[model samples]
Target: MNGRPVRVVENLNHALHESMLADSRLYVLGEDIADPYGGAFKATRGLSQANPDRVITTPISENGIVGVAAGLAMAGDAAIVEIMFGDFAGLAFDQLLNFASKSVSMYGRPHPMRLVVRCPSGGSRGYGPTHSQTLLKHFIGIPGLSLFEMSPFHDNRAVLAHMLGLGEPCVFIEDKVLYTRRMAGDGQVDDLFDYGFLGAGDTAPAHVYTEAHGDVDCLIIAPGGMAERALAAMRDLLLRHEISCRLVVPSRLYPVETDALLDAARHAAHVCVVEESTAGGTWGAEVAHVLHERLWGRLRRPVRLVHSADSVIPTAVHLEREILVQADTIVEAVLADLRGEGSPV
Candidate 1:
């Protein structure tokens, strides 16, 4: 886990620590997020020790976490609540939807104390459906709350720092699958809530860093769960035929920022959107739509879709991989786009 080249971004940790330090009014409360035990996922590790008074661990109650966070926010405190999984958050919907997400507009609260609730959601660990639900679509209609899902290890730090700075009620989703994705078959790191930036291990912040090399024809936007497959395909392509490529892994998945993506596509003649979510009414489609609407004719090739079939994740490992996007499939799609073999309209 040490002395190995990794895309480990301690940025999320830095953001949490820095945010807590800068504001004494900030507090974080959730299950298993206290001292000694760290957290259910270690994102809350060491947080309790640094800010003892502010960092309190609540009972095994999602409803209480949401309800209390709402009250804290009403009192003008920046309270960060953690849920173990997105699926488990269903129990707290009454508190979140009826309270936290609605109170500001419903009650017309003056200050609207901010809340940042963090959780680890999605699949890839054979953890089953109880933990595999990517329930972002459910929260989309919950107007007035900020939503953020971090996919890559690189952007976890930057995205987090930005979200914590916004001073809004934010839902931060950290996928469990990314905790140990490899860099070179040697080491790994937790892919917590960094967004739109790169982490060179303990080194200084990196600016959009990637090893994708080739003739450089297409830009692929692969979010959290599918990033590794996309990167692996890029590497394999370069090894096979020396084709230049660029991949934009948005650390912040939901509530996407279109400007940064458009900027990347400015150089990429072709574009593709990859996600583990179903293609039906997903964010990837919106990204492709926006790229066309904003930067018409800038793309030399059609946008390709690499996503899971519109079905629940199957239980079998091989079955799951079959339904999800694959490295080989990503390479094939890129090759099609580069070779002018894909749909141009």
Candidate 2:
């Protein structure tokens, strides 16, 4: 919490601990969530021990886990239910869609059922088909529930605390691999601070841009792992003399606050949007449309976009990494945008 002591990895752990500490009603229910396993990635590592009754570990049935949580939410208690892995969430569709989402808007009350159905998604760690899946695309159209896509490890600590205090129903998806690979000893557990990759274009694939405003030829927007990779690609482009550029990372993907994206668009001569998801109806494509309609003339050059080609997230580690939108792919897109022939692969 002191000067530059915060790390992304540790920030996540701090969020859960702080949220629970602040609110006793915030109970945790999910398979293997109790100490030891810590719900697979140890996000809930110390919850069971610290809070005791507040952290209730559950059986393997994803449906039962969520169903119980939904009932609790409807009863005016919001519970943070982890869906274990993204793939297994299929078992609890009925509860997630019909019950939890509806209890909020369908009843026409004061937005009751304040619960968060959390999932750790995305493909990485080579866990294969069932485990390695980025299912955010499927939930994009679901109504009655707020969707939150978390990609920033440091901001997560504060964001989680804020979301809990709001008392609204939200599906918070945690990128599964972030547990070990990303989280370390961040100081967020001690205090709340502003952690983002979206101010004045700082972060790229993972770490946001830490620099002050530079003369950027273009602004590239990418979130999750791709955000850092895309920025790397932007740097590579600069190296090759293709162009100078700034990068904007919408660290939070779903329920994306357009204010930040619009600001990024306004700063650069042009902007390119990218993501590790589908092109049509995706968060990236949505951003491009917003720019075209709202900030059209503000940009000297045409709006640019970069995204993952429409394809299944493969199971093979090497192939999967290749299929994902990479830094080189983003650089290629920037090159195309430079020539006035925009190509977002």
Q: Which candidate should be chosen as best, given lDDT against the real structure?
A: 1
User: What is the lDDT of every predicted structure here?
Assistant: 0.67, 0.66
TM-score, candidate 1, is 0.78
TM-score of each: 0.78, 0.83
- Error of model 1, residue 98, in angstroms: 4.6
lDDT of 1 by residue, 244-314 (tens): 56767665555666777777778777888876666667777778778888888666665777766667777
Model 2: per-residue lDDT, tens digit, 1-345? 355544444567787788888877777899888987787776778889998888888988989888898788777676888887878888888787887777777765666676777877777567766776666666665666666656544367656765665555677766664554443134121122213444442221222332335546787776554544654675577667757666554444556567777766676777877766656677666667777888876776666666555677777879887766667787777777777884634
